[model samples]
Target chain A: MPIRGSDRTSNRRAGGSPQRRLGARKRNQESLSGDPESCSPSDPRQVFTRRYRASIRTGQEPPSQRCSKAIHQGFELEVQLYPLKSQLVLPGDSLTARFIDALSAARLSARNGDIIAVASKVVSLSEGNIVSLRKVRTTALARKLGRKFEMLPEFAQVVLNEADAVYGGVPGVLLTLKNGNAIANSGVDRKNALGDSVIPWPADSHRSAERIRRALNRKFRKRIGVVIVDSRVTPLRLGTTGLAIACSGFKPVRDSRGIKDLYGRKVQITLHSLADGIAGAAQLLMGETQETIPFVLVRGAPVQLGGSYSSNSMTLPVKDCLYMSQMPSPSIMERDHG
Target chain B: MPIRGSDRTSNRRAGGSPQRRLGARKRNQESLSGDPESCSPSDPRQVFTRRYRASIRTGQEPPSQRCSKAIHQGFELEVQLYPLKSQLVLPGDSLTARFIDALSAARLSARNGDIIAVASKVVSLSEGNIVSLRKVRTTALARKLGRKFEMLPEFAQVVLNEADAVYGGVPGVLLTLKNGNAIANSGVDRKNALGDSVIPWPADSHRSAERIRRALNRKFRKRIGVVIVDSRVTPLRLGTTGLAIACSGFKPVRDSRGIKDLYGRKVQITLHSLADGIAGAAQLLMGETQETIPFVLVRGAPVQLGGSYSSNSMTLPVKDCLYMSQMPSPSIMERDHG
Candidate 1:
């Protein structure tokens, strides 16, 4: 059932929605004190916590009450975005094993429907997508595109070499199509790699997610969803938000085409891509700058799970996308750099 | 302090950072049963929640123990994104008053440093930005642009009339600049409007945010940050993410210009736009087909607060913007309708 205004307005700490008939499982979590507190002004953390406390009192369930939780429970409400701190994964390290170990340490196991969001970087490392810039031979186009973007010659060459198509360039960033996903630097990241080598998006990130999900399921013996995510710049907006490179185990888009709005009008053109949305939500906790959090836990997202899905389920070709199709093509990159 | 990998692996809840000194406030919240449970495979929520419960163990802090938190004693850590449900807002209704009442009904009050994110639609409603399609006379330009975007003639007229410039069109959407934001249909929204009239973004969203911030402060006697957000589609990506149209009391951009990454290299091109990220997180709960939530509460996010900021802080000139500068100008729109 959809959450209502009154359900939230009620004084109950959990905003306990009426869907609760499974009373046997409910725990007594009423007296959690991790709710509200006034923090120091000068400390940004204090200010943030202080501000968070005030807002939480009127409109939220404290993190303590919920703890580290997503518990899909078939609807979306009262949620936390948990970015776990983890040590850097060495190239060829078993990311699945590491994640399972971390979750186990923290006392977590995959349920039949949990979605594990792993940064594409670690997946690339595990898949051995890392390549030294020194090993890449620079091409003429790479040099020109690199100089145009004012990027280092090797990384620029890497971007060109990896891309399916080089669309164009803006200051400090490039627009390219790598394996059907539109990304910057062709999904090659230099951030947080162990040494001189940069990491390319896993050869097949969707498969990577599938692999991880299967391994986790084998260990816990439960079906789970997995999405490999990376950061990319949005047009006209500075910085990046998480975009799913690959996903498995759920329909990525929540098609709201025939759903009625509050006015009873059938909503059209309102397809909510659930995987990308979840990735973006995860990005809030895993900020840019290569955060130590390579893994994020999203539960209780109320998504359409079961029946495996691929990253291609939500991806459209360049000719099919809204803005990418209309933009100038690779010829723009071939234009005179000077 | 940056979150460490070992802390997460050590098996203590809250990641047990050695940096923490507020020992007396910490609680032993083990034995919580909200982890993963094997439900029928078709029951995705049960599965998601089940996986979540397992992950929640061994690693996360329980709510009861972190009671009345923020010793800040220093720093910010894990956080939640809460989307609140409220009734439809009428034109000229006091958004601040409605928000205050809604929050009050839910037992939440504004506290020092809290960040209140109000959807630009409601803010526009409060500021009387609703307009009638019947009253809008279609111009030759509007009809042509409308035909191009496959929109209604009068609605087309509004989009054209509201924009500073009509850049171009794609399959199902148009690109326009309303105020400084590159948006679809000049940011006019019809989803939750009362009758035939659609609501446009506030004339000066920056001023609207500033007004809300000031009013809330006067009412609560506390300094809280306010961000006016709207959903927009990103280039090359389907679906919408939150974009900040206006903000008050924080630097929306987190300048990580000289900060060191894990590799100890001075990070560049990692400047994070904090406001936009929070909005994206909020969107995870606030689906586009018009859910009950128009206001989102974000607390404990590490953002610079105080001394006020304008939407311009997160925006760039059209010439300086990465995407807009390269796009075809109005002359291109004026060039051909045939």
Candidate 2:
């Protein structure tokens, strides 16, 4: 079941006067305006809405008893499945078109306060982020680094193919060839697309989200939210959870300091990653294989919406140090093709 | 803001056919004339209630712009904080008595479907789980193992004090001295409680929960759920979340397979962990330090009461390879107190 607001009553302690005030503000704002779009600028009221909800069909095992036990105690598990649609082929925008068409065929609509989750692979394919390794020239540094990391020739070729310019390289750590994303091999992809072609990360996911949101709103005649999601490695965790690479019409962070607990004790150093949580939930629906659900509808979330757009606000600086540096390089992108 | 259930429209997508059957079963059970004195068995029909609500407080900063964006996109954030109470002392029944008395003192006028969250520490103390490290006779193996783990002499003494027998140890891992908790130094405690004595892990938390539930029912003449909660180390996460060590008068698990999504896709492998979610919510009220709220009342959860108690059902075995192995251990009962 989707995590809901009523499940959080225990968090409101006896003497949380500060939390009460915040709750009152939100309640007041919600009461004053029935719809998010009606709120005026400088109202201090944020409005949010659901964009899309997709349910992927999969054959994965149910959560183990241990995982279920954890959930019973209040942690949530969300999965997203992205199965290759048979009607669409890779190496073209036809897949993107088909995906959009499928949503429309289903009569799926995005609304203001909705966050639509789209797979990064779909975005990459639509933007023609594919690279042909055969046309690329590899440098001496690439050769040495490839040998050290046991990287295959095709993988190295693909990495070199996507490079705008290669940064410094060590045996295992090949610096990014791009400025925006510092992923190994510059976020190149070799798997899941078409044959013999590698897909590079989308040029600007934030822009992509905004564009999609705008297009969907125009098509549906309603306001909507968009979240372009990718699976990223977290520091020290074994498996991967989805991350919101770009978002429109949502707040991705929450700060809880100077807040009082139920017993009236002040809360400090509590900032929650709201986007990551939702992304994780969406990922549960969008699975690794055999499940084709790409989008999820999130409703009943309390949030404020506005016309102003800002993607930089979601980017975490390298100095923050919360992210792990040891994420497996995009070598998997190249190695998977063979 | 607490995580609330999906709106009525979304319920069709959120609930499965099996869940619907379970809901039917619950309704039938509610209508049946069963003896009210016996504790009700927990089933899939129960919608676990969160003890805390994650909302913006007056003095607190709103969610970060990034998070706000996610929220605006229909992602929700619900947090629970469990603050440890400090006013009560340990190793005595009086603390339990006081807690029960305080609970009884609180008006018993809550609406139906309210749950009372109780901390495990107080239950452990009342059960005489506290130990005095100064009273132990340390073995040479204990000393050697203590040196390897950089354990303080007092902490080592506490471990020895609690053990019925000291088993041999590997290089970094300490074999349990008793009760198979597999904890460092047999789950000895030094911090959080007042004074120089240490505390051991609670024994038979399920029994404790059942006892407490029966006691409360007799006293209040009301049907309510009781959850005994403790903070546990998750395999992959950095920090701790509360777990339901034991529960009475509620179905703590939910199975959601064969459920149809909004688009009519079958949902498999989606069992909701109602108990753990409730426990985590309760933790928000039972803080580790400073905040003195150890109990919370949760209302409006959709669940059915049940008989039969099993704490072992909630324990995730260490054998799961997918589970993280390197979570930081809690400082309770096993800290270096020089």
Candidate 3:
């Protein structure tokens, strides 16, 4: 079955104002005529004629006009990451207000279905989550951890306090699981903080993200998703990419249980981590340097808006984690050559 | 240090033709004037005035005219993912040639500095890396393993043959380390394969990516990077996203050592997994289902082009893996609440 323009408009108009429906139609027409070739992969013209439609699905498109034309007269989807620069965020500052200010200052409005990815550091800074090393009381375990990982005892105490589970680490970095996500130093950091002070990842990042999302939604009167982005190192991988510590206003993962493969076989275990990918894309723009790009507006991301999901929707139990559960002993690991 | 247009042109024009230099300049000017506000984060006009110049850096831009306007005459970086739909690829097909064909058929020519991401499944298909389960002579160990994992003995044998180390499994999936990457059943799958056969991940994904890169470079005379992508499920995360099994023609990991954070502190232990982020972004476009998009052209990615790094540049030793190295015993893991 081909998805006609009428079908898309009808689905899109649901819960949307007649004015917005007219606006979307007007925008789509303008986009269709402007490039004539920038059709989405889900567009009926492309999906039905050139390729097989495993199923009919409609994805939300942001109002941004930037797109790359793929195949003459074909609709190709382009996910755009707009890194938003901000003023120096201070302790107890309103993150939602600051973000709204930044957007309006840039003359860009938050549209319906837009994703706002903010670095967790700024989120923590705004929450006044910083801890002074001088105020920290070190435990015996903290002192031992500091000696093992080459860190100050006060810093180690903070790490231990924030960590859900402490794992061994190479010198200078402690690996831990914080809120079910594997992170370095339990997402504690000294950079961008006062000397002799550190900031742990926001307490209950999921709730923080939801608070910001709710505020933004109320202010903008639009359906928007918010993801608290954090830089994380993966197992055996170098450098840091974005990880979603928390997400709100969308189903962060796409379940592909009933989806058919190219051969019509049902894909059993394919779940798309929409939040992580959005975070990674945002991290690509938010450099680790002194640039003030704390907020990234992700437009045209393929995500379902409006879902009541748990904050821990993306986390897995330690016993169920692939790398954690299946870790072999050192001798067994040494026997095989990678 | 402010990076001028002249500086970027000089750095980009090294070992290149005068014709291309003019083309890049013309394109940049057209892009600058067309949007007026479409400057790169590295663009001096934006970096010097509003944002702090942590350091001066210039990144490559593909020859695509798509970009979003940021700030009042500010330069913004827009990384674009173009998912490409290809014809049904059969065994013994020339992947490089087929990719070029797909690009040309779409009227999109390969551009210099463009990162091409190809699905590993298709690469295996092109290499005819399929096995008939009937031909496999499963050992007693394989039979037992199959019974435990609810897999056929022949399939378990193939997995054992490909895997470097097998730790454990849930009922239907076995977690194994293949080429230093933790994956399921050593990247073997029956989807899109013959009913009685399964296709394993390409034996040498790194070399395969290099092969594609060299062939494309020869054909287009462009310095392009190729990444062999495969969908992977992360630990404790739902849904699959793109993972780069092999990368060629660029440094897949960006070292952030000695870089200054926003507080002028020397940031350590931040290596950006450029390949993985690129793969994840491409995966966002390449659906897990019957969408025939096997290749995604990534443009405006913040990767330093023209490097001779090894294929395993993105991999880390198992002992050094954060999740693998620090995995606790069942008793220790059980005591902690995550």
Better of 1 and 3 by lDDT: 3
Arrange candidates, best lDDT first: 3, 1, 2
Chain B alone, TM-score, model 1: 0.74
Which structure among the candidates has the greatest DockQ?
A: 3
DockQ score, prediction 3: 0.25
- Model 3: iRMSD? 10.6
lDDT agreement of model 2 with the native: 0.45
Worst 10 residues of 1 chain A by lDDT: A24-33
Highest lDDT against the true fold, candidate: 3
Candidate 1 C-alpha lDDT tens digits along B1-338: 11111122112122112222132112111111332221244333333333333433322221211131221111114455566656677877888877776566454566445678889888988788888988888878777766877788888777766777666776545677766677877788777666678778888888999999999989988767888888777665656667788888776776667666667766656766778877776666665664656777775555656765667667667666555655556543323331
| Residue A79 displacement (Å), model 1 | 1.3
How does each model score on TM-score?
0.76, 0.44, 0.79
lDDT of 2 by residue, B38-137 (tens): 2233311111111111111111222222232222222222221222223454466654455554443332233234566787767777788876666666
RMSD of each: 12.5, 15.7, 10.1
Instruction: Show what share of the native A-B interface contacts model 1 retains.
Output: 0.27
Question: Residue-pair clashes per candidate, as listed?
Answer: 29, 107, 12
| lDDT per residue as tens, model 3, B197-293 | 8889998888888888999999988778898888877766666767888898877887767767767788766678888888888887776765667
lDDT of 1: 0.63
Reference-based lDDT, each prediction = 0.63, 0.45, 0.69
On a 0 to 100 scale, what is the lDDT of residue A277 in model 1? 75
